[model samples]
Target: MEAVLYAQERSKETRATLNSLRENGNIPAILYGKNVSNVPISVEKLDFKKQFNEIGKNGIFTIDVDGKRQQAIVRNYEVDPITREIIHIDFLAVNSLSVITADVRIVLVNDAEGVKDGGVLQQSMFDLSVTTNVNRFPDAIEVDVTHLQVGETITVGKIRQQYPFEINHENDEVIASILPPRQEEEISTGEEQEPGIPENLEGREE
Candidate 1:
């Protein structure tokens, strides 16, 4: 799906002017890419929401500034803590041949064999940094958990072989693991980490 956004170039970068832009229902953003400095612009909130819902964050979209169109990807965005509204967004211009570095999700498919046997499933890693041509990178990576047994694990080094992109993670980093069922009298349990193979991950920033 193709999505396009039309934005007006912003010249007044003062705080007061930016606040006024937001008050008028526009989202202030910047355009950045290789050999390109940040270019400030603003977009109508309603138009942005409509197109964003169609193409999603990772998909490529066209940003038209005063009739000049540039292909770009959503690099990052910020939300207002008080009202939970989108405040600022950063866009990175991209080409189809570019090898983009982005976060792709990891999902477990099929009920684990261990989970069927009263074992717990621990998903420590939810997303991974992957490097691949923009056309090849997937929205997510699905891992088969049909055969995982108690005390078994799937690690970064092990799972990357099943995909096209290179997973930028340490070899021993655990992705998913099956743990033995918890025993009775396990205190300090409510609203906490899982009992066995507790989710342990020092997630990286994309």
Candidate 2:
């Protein structure tokens, strides 16, 4: 989880730098620490894109700011609405050994038996935030979908603990469910195409 990141010192304070950085494939960011004051910094967009994709938005990061290393985590990120281009980023300083809470992405594994039986799989929660030491945090939560049956609900409490962390979400919150799949394929083929039928449902490509 601890990886070295390099950044440049910037102080122009103009929002135009943000645009300029984007054009150069760099991220406009600020580094702030409880022990250190806020400092303007810029990082290569390509480097950040790779790290973010692998570690996610909340994982621990070791940033080298002006040759001084600091332990931090991503606090916020802004992306273009239409183009989905990253714009702004914020980093919060933290001790590498300190305990912190972060939301980890949930990955559904295997094809559910219920879905194979003409049932729809609903992922209610995409991520589960937890409290744990920085060194002990997990990259993601794995929820097995193989045993789920139609109309069966998987709650946060049902997850097998593979890591030593405290789950902060409600135990009763359904993370995934098996519902009856839509039987509209037969009807749609026979009828004219309707307006406003999206290509994907719930942001899934299917």
Q: lDDT of all the models against the reference?
A: 0.87, 0.84
Supply every candidate's count of residue pairs whose N, Cα or C atoms clash at under 3 angstroms: 0, 0
TM-score of each: 0.84, 0.76
- Residue-wise C-alpha lDDT for candidate 2, range 1-206, written one tens digit per residue: 45678998898877787678779888889898677799899999889888877776667788998898988888888888999987878988889667878888899999999999999999999988889887777778888999899989999878736557899977788999999778664444466656875666547765
- Per-residue CA lDDT of model 1 for 1-206, tens digit only, reads 66789999999889999899899999999998986677999989889988887776677878999998888888999999999999888989887777888998888899999999999999999999998987676877898999999999989988878888888999899999999999888687568555664345345444
RMSD after Cα superposition, model 2: 12.4
Candidate 2 segments whose C-alpha is farther than 4 A from its true place: 16-18, 160-163, 180-206
List residue ranges in candidate 1 displaced over 4 A: 186-206
RMSD of each: 14.6, 12.4
